[model samples]
Target: MKHSILLVEDEQKIAEGIMDYMNGGEAEYETCFTWADDGDKALELVYENEYDLVLLDIMLPGADGFEICKAIRAKSYVPVIFLTARGREEDRLYGYDIGCDDYVVKPFSMAELSAKIMSFLRRSKGLWEKKSSIEAYDIVIYPDKLQVFVAGNEVRLAPKEYAMLKYFMEHRGMLITRDDLLVRLWGYDYEGSDRVVDNHIKKLRQALGEPGKKIKTVFAKGYRMD
Candidate 1:
């Protein structure tokens, strides 16, 4: 099937290479590209047209990618990816927090990126179609609403934190290793520090407040949610 992709980048050359691969016959998935040179124009495109996926650059002219990703998440569930030179752990975590579907550092392998793009696209095809809410003690998460409620009060959570809570709810009372989280949430292609999962877990606990105690850390192995 053919997919529509928005390619947002300031550099003329980098965008061209990606576009070439997507448009060229080499890619497994057939895709068409809409190019934007800056963040302002990118947002304009986002508002004006409907795209299946977005390839975003973190450092752009009008608004940075983090802002753009948050805006996109506020409106749509369409996949948004950060393709930038920033490889720092904080940046990657921040991207996940702001609801970016994936983060790819620059000087990257084109083949691997192409593969990841398709992977996200495929996985998100029927994403979040579930309407039922998952509840654990005082914390409740609605997959359809993308909202979290603690003690009957609505509490905002980062995207990654929300996902963690959902996963924990789904596997309550089961041992989930750090490696398990790294693979399940971050994907096998992820190259960031394993500490990212721990960082996210810490923040998720803080978000859940009193109910956070239910997430039991299993020594060095992993965590089990009650």
Candidate 2:
């Protein structure tokens, strides 16, 4: 399904421009731009609807973008990309602090914004459309299907565990560090520690069973699938 998007901007010209850009044939977005003259109206709409993304402007009549962002972050981790004329370093840092996924400065290219939006969506969903299958020794990983077979027998794995194993199978013989696994599988912005990777690895190993060297621990580095 096409993800729904909410755009909250007070300026009519700027809001129309962005809406047009988003609705253009080149842009593959099923977006609903909510042109709110004030933040209060935008916040109300946010509370009323479940949107996949929010494009917020910094300066608004009622609550302001920062306040609205904080309010949204309190309830949801919905992808937020700020669209504003405020290009100050402090404003950027504050936006990031409040969990803004991206900040686009004014006079930015619509094409670039579209690309950024696509990138964020892909990362958020881990939307790997390519169906990939890898066979490493006695283990087989089917990424598209989110299934695994160990020694030709179906073995159940958790979602994250399956992603980890699939990573290993594709990068067989490569010594992947804890950081590498965390970023690739969990996401680059994941706040969790490397211990999460270790825990998931343990689960993956247990699921794969004996001949677990298919997923080998490389001492201080991390893991390798041989």
Candidate 3:
């Protein structure tokens, strides 16, 4: 599969070099790259296009890469790699804190960066293949089919309800906030209230019947699949 990558870097030479290396056939898979010299443009591409991975520079002309990464995290789980000159421990920690998949300091080798990108891509593909379907308790979810089975009986779910249930089943024990669900399922452009998440969760639970008992409401927080 040809993976699309967004390269956000201010330095034209550096960006071109990285792009050339990525597409130069050093790896087994083909990588097509789009270059963005400013953070605003980066965010615009991120919102409008679906990229397999993002190669982001920390300091940019408009908004910083950290802010861009946060915005991306709000809507999608696309992998983000910070390629920057800021090599401080705190900077690296902050990158991870803000949801960067990997951080590579400036003056880095293109070969190493290519290897890292390949590794992340392979792992992501493996995970998606492995999670094609999931079973928890008496509930089985076929994500590819958008079908749910409870106690050997198939349950019909609304689009959003199926998405919510699939998210819950995937995260299982993790606490999922309403904001997380809203941004993830409804998109960043959604102007609806957080109560929408509650309404959907209620309907999702009702749809699941007995298996829905595992979906627990956490007071003042969000829902968790026990």
Candidate 4:
């Protein structure tokens, strides 16, 4: 699959250069680049389409890259890299504080930036592979097939229920909030209430039978798969 990236940079020349380098066949995987010249447009694009990674410039017309990164983090776990001319120690620290996966300074070599992107991509791929299929508590989950088996017995589940279960299994020990599930599974455009998450979780647990006890509910919080 071709990985899509959103490049949010105000400088047209710099943006084009980065695009050329990324599309120049340096990486092993195919890449599709989408450019956003302003911060507002960047935010709009992120909400409209899913991206594998985001390259943001610190300086922008409508909003700064830091603000954009913060907004993205609030909704999604997409990898973000700050490509900016601001190379100060405090600036880099702030970028990390706001959850940027990587920070690259201006005048950076395209080769180095490309390597950084590839590294993150590889790590993301590894995580996906690790979570793709998991066997726990006598329950087996095949995320790609959307199938779940308990003690060798196939369990039928609705589409949403399957997705919710897969997400819970992937993040087994994490305290996943309802908003996190909404954003990860339903996307930012979902207009439904948070109660939808609760309903799905209930159905998912019921479908898995005895093994479903691994999915624990934290009162006033969200569900967690043990």
| Candidate No. with top lDDT | 3
Q: Which lDDT tens digits does candidate 4 get at residues 1-226?
A: 9888899999999999988888888777788999999999998987788778899999999988999999998866677999999998668767766667677999999998998887667546445336556677887887668778989998988888877776665455657777667766776556789998888887877888887788898888888776
Better of 2 and 3 by TM-score: 3
The superposed Cα distance between candidate 1 and the true structure at residue 44, in angstroms, equals 1.1
Cα shift from native, residue 15, model 2 (Å):
0.9
Q: How do the predictions measure up, each by TM-score?
A: 0.62, 0.56, 0.59, 0.57
Residue-level lDDT of model 2, residues 1-226, one tens digit each, is 6767788888888888877888777576566666677899988987887667788999999989999899888776677889999998668767766767677889789889887776556544322233365666787777657778888998998888887776565445557788666655665567877898888888777777885656878898888777
lDDT of each: 0.81, 0.75, 0.83, 0.80
Encode model 1's per-residue lDDT on 1-226: one tens digit a residue: 6888899999999999998977787677799899999899888888888778899999999988888888787777777879999998778877865667677899889888898777666655444333366666988788878999999999898888887888777556667788667765877567899899899999988988989889999998999886
lDDT of 1 at 1: 67
| RMSD (Å) per prediction | 8.6, 9.0, 9.2, 10.2
Looking at candidate 3, what is the lDDT of residue 52?
Answer: 80
lDDT digits (tens) for residues 63-108 of candidate 3: 8999999988886667789999999866876776666767899899
Judging by TM-score, tell me the better candidate of 3 and 4: 3
Off by over 4 Å in 4: 126-226
